[model samples]
Target: MRNSYRIALAGNPNTGKSTLFNALTGLRQHTGNWAGKTIALAEGTVEHKGKTFQLIDLPGTYSLFSNSIDEEVARNYIVFEKPDVTLVVLDATSLERNFNLALQVLEMTTNVIVCINLIDIAEKQGIKINERILTKRLGVPVIKLSARNKIGFPLLLDTIDRLVTGAIECQPIPTVYQDHIEEEIKKMEPRVSAIIGDRLSARWVSLRLLDGDEKLLQEITKRLGEGRE
Candidate 1:
């Protein structure tokens, strides 16, 4: 039986993502640079119900479009590595802006759980988040907690356990684009799916190609070439 699962933690800058990572992994975590890249990543592990989860703290970025090296590393890790679960941390006080990254993550993978951190501060500021509405709208589980106060950690851990054990199912909502853009995606999706071959999200890849993401294209070509060798 598989007792270990890979989980990726991603979010925008200053969303308390690193704090949550440290809280969950404690002294078990380590920081290291990704292969051949100056950018560093933090990794750690947590045990829940006799199962182990290896968590990788990805560099914070606003979007996964790969506009910079940080975005590129985070994007490639999620799209290529295909972690067992992706915990997208969002700031409850600034959820409107944070949704940009969360939505992109849903578009890329269905194995996702949205975490609204810093809820206590948001409440003090008179900001409220209806996680139920978010879950219904996004078609994935939504959780709220204060990573700093260590509140909601139990539910968060249980949620992760259910997701990893297949006790919960995620049906990520698809991102709707303008009609013309959707038409272009439709034209390219099949071909992109063929090329990617279950390794990544074809629709997401097609969108990047349309946007002239040469880096992603180069990486895909390199990977495909390597596969053929």
Candidate 2:
């Protein structure tokens, strides 16, 4: 029997996330609205290296911190669903703006692959990115490609396979917060760990608590039961 993995594609609007999903899955795709929500959901299957990967294209949003429905859907899915890998597509031409979402996703999940799409356009506009340095800094694989043109698909597949199969170990470097905020996180981490334990990242849970994200707190309580907290 062939193994299967679930992958989520996340990024800001106009980042070519859907384009990459289509390239990877071709005609093997389906779309529908998320349960109890108006946001559309796209999922597709791709077979590579004797394994099948189910890719979910999440709604595009500027930042997961926003309270918009799209942001909530994207954030909640990654935090609760816990996909095998979260592939974050970035617009290479506007990396600075696009990176905001990338960094936010990294905070929520360590299983991430930064896909810098639109490399062809970036090059045409005299923009360049150092993937190696980025990978080292983020402590996750960074792939550059023109998704529309199908460049770098092979490498992307290999990286995804390696990550999902545990052939490659990923140790994401946590983002540094303000000193006071870090202190609060350190204090709350133990309690958060006791609540969610290994089901979610303790530090991230602590941060959410500090941010007073009522919706996320409510979701956590609902999912894990009110007594868990």
Candidate closest to the true structure, highest lDDT: 1
Cα error, residue 29 of model 2, in Å, equals 0.7
Q: Tally clashes: model 2.
A: 0
TM-scores of the candidates are 0.97, 0.96
Give the Cα-based TM-score of candidate 2 against the true structure.
0.96
What is the lDDT for 5 in model 1? 95
**Which stretches of candidate 2 lie above 4 Å from their native place?**
226-229
Q: lDDT of each structure?
A: 0.93, 0.92
Ten-residue stretch with the least lDDT total in model 2: 220-229
lDDT of 1 by residue, 1-229 (tens): 6889999999999999999999999999999899989999799999999999999999999999868999999998998888999999999999999999999999889889999999999999999788999999999999999999999999989998999888999999898899999999999999998877888888988898999999989988887898899
C-alpha RMSD between model 2 and the true structure: 1.8
* Residue 107, model 1, lDDT: 87
